[model samples]
Structure formats: structure tokens, C-alpha cells
Target: MKKIKEVAGNNTSDLVEMNRSAIVRILQQMDVCSRADIAKITGLTQASITKIVAVLIDMGIVTEVGFVKGEGNRRSIGLRLNAEKNLVIGVKFSRHVFSIGVFDIRGKVYTQQETEFGLDEFASDVVVEMKKQIHDLLKKYKNVVAIGFAVPGPYLRKEGRIALVTKMPSWQNVNFVEEFENEFDKPVFIEQDANAGALAEWWFGNHGRPINSLAYFLAGEGVGSGIVDHDRLILGNLGIASEIGHISIDVKGPACECGNKGCLELYCSANALLKKAEEILPELFEEEYENRWEACNRVFLAAKEGNEKALELTEEIAEYLGYGCVTLINAYDPEIIVIGDSISQGGDLLLPTINKIVKERVIPEISGKVQIKISKLTVDPTLYGAAAIATDKVLRKPSEYLVSK
Candidate 1:
């Protein structure tokens, strides 16, 4: 019910498809429901529900499961989505690593693998390896219907290129659309990492129902935010809206790769935490860390162990993260804010300080109503988000992408 949006279209066929999408989304959430239940939830007439369900059954997208108790103790046929028959591939591309996974429409992951590469690695070579992995997965997962790709923020949707990646300049010119659009037999959909995270939370997250708006705050290699309002992604003109990482927190702060001063990313990102940790807690860095996440966790672990300096460093990062949350609340007015990514591993050590700052900074009336929680997704949010991007599209037009057994 929370996923349903108001249907609008001038064309009758388009309207019908929209209605079908609504029904499918409901089944995706509820798992099983009667036509009467769907009609009541969607506010559509039972006749329309019957008509839509019949077509969906004919298409093999939906099937009658059996009789189930309906509202008022009445008996009605149960309907459900044939989720196992439709699969998607999720690909997450970052500076140091790229991950690919196979997932069904219901967010069940079949398999995933991560490949690490250096900053100096040829972008073309990395992409080639990525394609090879994806091609291999496609061969093994015959049910896969589409592929979803997630890249760093400020990604130009129209141009299909990252306008600017923090440490990776070579990728800025690698047109993702040109490289991926025709590379696979199945349709490939691309979205910025933050937006993809938002979709992952929207579709797969268990944040309770009827979430009018949700914000996903990403604090890892880079800081960013993604917003989902009323079951729709708030994509700006170039599909880069809600990029909270680029928002300047300090006008006089250091210069950022995004050509801005004091961007939120420079302060709360894993790199920022590492820089401060190196200065105050140099002993923790005696051994080289495999990645930024490991280094950041070292600081958090030290804080948990009662190291005063480590606690201070984590508190500072938490304050910056709190500032990011405040900005998210003011800009998007999300019902819930979900903090995720490498930095979120701080867990309990970070929440108290972050929540305190938010309570002090935001008006009580607003702050009291907003719920903040760390992401509990079993899979990496960005990787799962890649699958969600494809899932969102397939659900919108089931007839075109979803295959019948």
C-alpha cells in the first residue's frame, strides 16, 4: 500500500499499465492478497482488480495461490507475484572495488563477488573485467531479466557519464551509457549510487509501511544522500537531485574535488576519518589496511575500547554526519533517515553523538517526528540497490521484461 502511487495518464493503455504496476507492487510487499484486499488498498473497484489480475495471470506474472481468509472473515482467492521466475543483476562500481550480484525480484540474492582494483588501474581494463563477470553471471542465471548499474554521485543521467568522481578522473570520460547500453543482451539501467541506495531501502528495507519519504545518507568513500518521496525517486533535471554530499557545510573549508569549498563529503567521508585517525591514533595504522573501511573501523574499535582520542575522532565524524542529517531533514523532510555505508559501521558509538547533535540543531517538533536508524540490509546497500534499480523498472512494465514460465 505504501508503494502505490497515484495513477495518471491520457492514454488508456498507459493507464492500464500503471494500474497493473500498482497491483504488482502491492503483491511485492504483501506477498499474497485477495482481489478484494487489493481493491480496498488501491481504492480501485473490484471489477478493475479482477480485470487486471486476469491479464496478469495470463502473462504468468501473477497466479492464484488458493483460498484465503479475506476481510470480515470472508473467503477469497489468494494472488501473488511469481518473483522466483524474474531475476536481476546488480552491479556496484566504486573507486577501489566493483561488485556484481544476482537477485530475484523479491530481493533474494543468489550470488555476489567483489573485485578490487587500484586507482591507477586502467578504467578500460576494469570495465572489461566487470563485463566479463556480468557475462558469466548471465550465462549461469538464465532467469535474469535485466541488469542495474550503480555509480558515484553527480552522475549525469542524460550523458551517462560521471560528471566528476572524487579520486578517479579517468572514469569521468568513460561514457557508461555507451559502454553498457548495448554490452548486455538484457536491458541495463544505471543510477547514481545514492539514488540506488534509496531504491534499495525503498523496495527491500523493513522500515515499516506507509513511509511517505525516506532519506538514505551514504557515508563511506564519499558522502551522499538519496531521497524517495511518495514511492518515486526525486530525480532532478539531470537525475542528480538530493546529492547532499556536495552541499557545502563550511564555506571556508578545504577545496573539494567537486570544485566546492567545505563540501560535506570532505568532513564525514571514510577518508576524512582516516586522516584524523592517522594524526591522533597513529599506532592503529602500524599495519596497512586493505581498504578505507578497515581503517575507519579501527578508529571505531578504538573508541569502543575507551580510547579518549579515538572517541574524540569518532565524535567529530558523528557531528559532521549529524550536520548531514540535519541538512537532509530540512531539505527533504523525510519521515525516516537511514544511515549506511562504511562509516555506519561505527554503530552504537556514533548514534548517541549524532542524535544529540540533531536534537540540538533541529526544531524539536520536526526532529521528534523523524526516525533515524542504521541500515540493516544483509547485502551491501549499493550492490542491492543496483538490483533494485532494475527491479523498479521491471515492475513498472512487467509485460515487456518479465517472462512467463
Candidate 2:
């Protein structure tokens, strides 16, 4: 009977909201539980639980279901979150493509669409198209309570502009907050794509409960990471804390777009993998690819089919990814690390080498406790992460976001 600790709030109202949020979060993960069960888990008095549950039930955020057995084997009413009624829109904006999805707080996806744009395409035009599509989805799904946007890092969260985006300099000037904050009627939450991925894995991914910390290593078109410690994102002063991709793996290596030499991104990103793939396996790219994910998949398929060159290339990439994991473990000491995005599609081919490297590089005690795995999210982690961003916010202050029926 380990009790879940609640986050302390500043004031009376804040404490009330935090208590409600804790209850809702438990329900979100557990699906259904009794007031006595919530009280036991949260360490809140039965009276406090009753008051908070009443508010949540009145706010249309929680509903009473059939009876369930309590701690002492007594029957008690079960309360569940009204997740289907509270939806969120997740938008993943990246170098070559943008995706939009509608999801509930429980990470259930209703619909998702992807739009690809050229690197030469105007940023303003892309924003216009994204806004139009979101509007269309909002019109269709009336239950949507908020919107979550995930942009590439090193995104300046406070400034609401991307500090730098490789090969896409034009996007640096666009203030996402100004662009989307007032554009939609519902509140809009913006986060770096990696951070979004972390939140997605934290709230949605099947990683089991009570995770002390989790790190999401994103190795897609761009390289980055997001960290979640104790149900909260580890956002630094400007909300961009874990930019692991820019960490220099080689001090004397080629200069990266971030002005760093021999950065991990240059060695392990989808761009990096494709660069080597095209040189070693020319026939694989005889035709154009719909996206980098597809291009990377071709190489993985080649390796899967026992192509020696492709296998070597994948091992090399996996070794670098392993290096990234080692760094993540030393830097954050997360309970688990999830490798995600396009590169993770090679999990079957990549894990053996990656694990071997980690086993060699890290201490036995540290390496033994840390579990590394590829993301198993059905939707793209970044897109699903966008929804998680909103879901995280809405769950925190249900009264503010969810309307009372």
C-alpha cells in the first residue's frame, strides 16, 4: 500500500486543484477506482476525497460507474474519467512533414493526417495550411478542449520561436505562440517535439505505472530528447532542457547546424543514416521516397533481408544510438529510455548492437536497472505527444479546462 505523493500547490485553490488533478491522473491510469481506493492511494483523508470527487463529478470530468470491491473487500462505487468527452488536438511540426491528430486524455487517437512540404516551401504557407486543417478538425470534433503543438528543438519555449532548425532557417523567426495562441478558441500548449514525445510516452505509452523518470530519445529527421521526471517535464529555465542531440560525440568531427562539431545528431539522425545509406546502397534509393521514414525503412528492410552492407550501416547507427543511451543514463538516470521516431523502426535490427554497446559502456549496476526499448505507440510519438501535452495540462486543472455539464 504505497501512497502516491501529490504535487504541492501555492495556495488554497491551487491545492484543491492539485488534489483533483491527482485523483484524475490516478483514474486516467487505473481506468476506474473507488473513492476509498483513491484516498488510500493519494493518502488524502476520506472527507477530502469526497469533496474533490464531488467537484470532479459535477465538472463533467469524472463519472460514477458500477460498484467495485474496496480495500477491506467491501463494495464501493467506482469513479472513472470522462475521457471521451474531453479531447485534444496534437500537431507535430517537423522539417519535412506536419501531422495532426485528435486524441482523448487516455491517449486514444480518433483521427490523424500528415502533410508533407518541401524544404523550400514558405513557412507562412505551411502555417496557413496547418491552421486550416486544425479548424476543420475542430469543427468536426466538438469535444476538443485544447490543442497541443510539437515543434522541432532547440525551440525557445518562452520566446515561442525555434532557436535553430537544421536546413530550415526560415522557421526560426516565426513566433509559434503569437501564431497559434489566439488563433484557436481553446487554449494552445506548445512544446519542443522531443518534450512532446516524452510526455506522450509518460502519459500514453505502456510503460507501467509509478515510473520515477523516463527519457524519450528522438532519432528522426532531427535528433533530440525529452525527459519526464515524476510526471512532470524537466524543462529548464527557457523550457528547453534536454537537447541531447546537439551534444558533441566527436569534438573534431564535422560542424553541425547548431555550430557544434561532431554532434550526436550528425551521427545518428535520419539525415545522417540516409547520407550513408545512399552512398553504400545506391539501388535502395533508385526511386524517390515519400518521407525520410520510408527511406530509412528501406535500409532496415535490406538489413532484415541479410544484406551485409545494409547490416553494417545499421550496426554503425545502432552503436551511435547506444552511445546516446549511455549519455542519457549518465546525464538523467531515468528508469527507462525509449528510442523513437523513424530510426526506431530498426529496433529489431538495432537493439542487439545498441544493448551490447550500453552493456560495455555503462557500469553493471546502472546498466542493469535501466531498460531501453523502442517506442510502441501506434501513432507517431511526436503527434501523440502533442495530444499528451494538452492532456497533461487539462488533467492538471480540470475545473479550468473541462466545462461542467
Q: Pick the candidate with the highest TM-score.
A: 2
How much does each candidate deviate from the true structure in C-alpha RMSD?
Answer: 4.3, 4.6
- Model 2, stretches more than 4 Å misplaced? 1-9
Clashing pairs in 2: none
lDDT of each: 0.92, 0.93
Against the correct fold, how does model 2 do in TM-score?
0.96
Q: Please give, for residues 27-118, the per-residue lDDT of candidate 2 as tens digits.
A: 98999999998898999999999998998888788999999998678999999999999999999999889999999989888999999999
- The superposed Cα distance between candidate 1 and the true structure at residue 56, in angstroms, equals 1.0
lDDT tens string, model 1, 1-405? 579787864788888988999999999888999999999989999999999999999999999999999868899999989999999999999989999999999899899999999999999999999999999999998999999999998899999999888889999989999999999899999999999999999999978787899999999899888899999999999998899898999999999988899999999998888888898789999999888878888898989999999989888999999999999999889999999999998998889988999999999999999998999998999999999999999999987889775
Count of steric clashes across candidates, in order: 0, 0
Give the candidate number with the greatest lDDT: 2
